[model samples]
Target: MSIWWSIHLRRDAASVPLARRLLLGTMETAGVDPDISYDLSVALSEACANAVEHGGDGDSAEAYRVTAYLDGEKCRIEVADSGPGFRPPSRPLPVRVASVEDEHGRGLFLIQALADHVHIGGKPGLGGTVVSFDKLLKWREDAPLIAV
Candidate 1:
């Protein structure tokens, strides 16, 4: 069985949590485990946040789009925006300095580590950025299996 969903929201931090909840709930119905839920949510939130922060110019009407698909044993998520695309930074981001104690610049890094596959580039023929990730869903041997 395949499940798909799409959302468009104003580019802002407030929309991030809603996106996560929507994606996570959809994924649960598709058999994603709870342990991996946070990882998926974090990766998606970061990608969407990047799209909003970098793509949207703090305009309330600017729209950010998120699409999710579950195909059999794999799940894929894509976040896009109406604003212009950007080339991701090539160098590693500097760690938080002891004196600074900041909590930023870790989004892309977290996505790279969590996702089984990640794609970041300009959407073809479109100006905005599209950040896509795919994860391989794992099944617990002890849990009841459903054959679709």
Candidate 2:
């Protein structure tokens, strides 16, 4: 079975949970293993939070996109934003190690740690960024969606 979804969300704090909840509901209905579903949900939350915090101009000039695809035993997701885009030495051209005492800056790292594969890129100053990732899925024995 192949299932997919996408949502355009404003860079609002409340929008973060809304995206997460929808992803969770989709996974649950598909009978994804609870642990795997939880992991993906957390990753989705982090991605959405990043978008809410840094994906746009300070004003209400930006919104972000999140897309997810579940095919057979793999799940793929992508979060995109229209921002200043990534510039080297500033944005996450290369994900850095956030110190333990740091209150922020771990979102991308968390996404990398949770997913099987991750890719972060954008056209510098061209006004867009994309964080894409995928993971192998584990389904419950009673999963309604047959892994095709």
Specify the highest-lDDT model's number.
Answer: 2
Candidate 1: the clashing residue pairs are: none
Residue range 1-148, candidate 1, lDDT tens digits: 7778899988878999999999888766656676666788999999988877887666867998999987777779999886778875565435443336656777887887888888887877878888898888764444343214
lDDT of every predicted structure (CA atoms): 0.79, 0.83
CA deviation > 4 Å runs, candidate 1: 89-100, 140-148
Candidate 2: residue pairs that collide: 1-148
* Model 1 worst lDDT window (10 residues): 139-148
Determine the backbone clash count of candidate 2: 1
Clashing pairs counted in every model: 0, 1
